[model samples]
Target: MVTSIILMNVERSKINEVAQQLADTEGVSEVFSVSGTYDLVAICRVPTNDDLSELVTRGLLTIDAILKTETMLAFKAFSRHDLETMFTIGLDGI
Candidate 1:
């Protein structure tokens, strides 16, 4: 899976509507209304780079309320599960 962090600058009057639209879009897993340079942040998961492009360019940009967006591609994902698995490796002797 390919993960991306999309930061969106939405029209001030339509932040809620834009967020809802993004959340409803396929491949978008989560949407957050954040206080920062960007009005909203969307987490997306897709199968390929081409799908990511379609989602952000064709799908997300089509939202009339979204003024601009910045997409960040994730190179790797580190989670508690990964840490636990690492620490547990070869620990049976303990």
Candidate 2:
């Protein structure tokens, strides 16, 4: 899976509406209103790079209300699967 974190500069009043729209998008998993240079942030997941690109090109960039965006592709994550499978408990005499 490919995941991206998008930071956006959105109009203050439109922040909520825009965030909801992003959250509802098929590839977007979550959205948050943040206090920073950017008004909103979104976490999105897609099957491939192409889908991620499509979402940025078609889903996000196409909107005028979205003044700007910065996208970061996730390289790592913490989860039960990663923790249990990657770490091994010592089996030798202790």
- Model 1 TM-score relative to the real fold: 0.82
lDDT of 2 by residue, 1-94 (tens): 9989999998777888898788888999889999869998899989999999999989896566888899999998874234344455762322
Candidate 2 regions exceeding 4 Å error are: 79-94
The window of 10 residues in a row where model 1 has the poorest summed lDDT is 78-87
Clashes per candidate (backbone, < 3 Å): 0, 0
- TM-score of candidate 2 on Cα atoms, chains taken together: 0.79
TM-score of each: 0.82, 0.79
* Reference-based lDDT, each prediction: 0.89, 0.85
How displaced is residue 78 in candidate 1, in Å? 1.3
lDDT of 1 by residue, 12-86 (tens): 999999888888999998899999799999999999999999998799768988888899999997752344455
- For model 1, what is the alpha-carbon lDDT of residue 31? 97
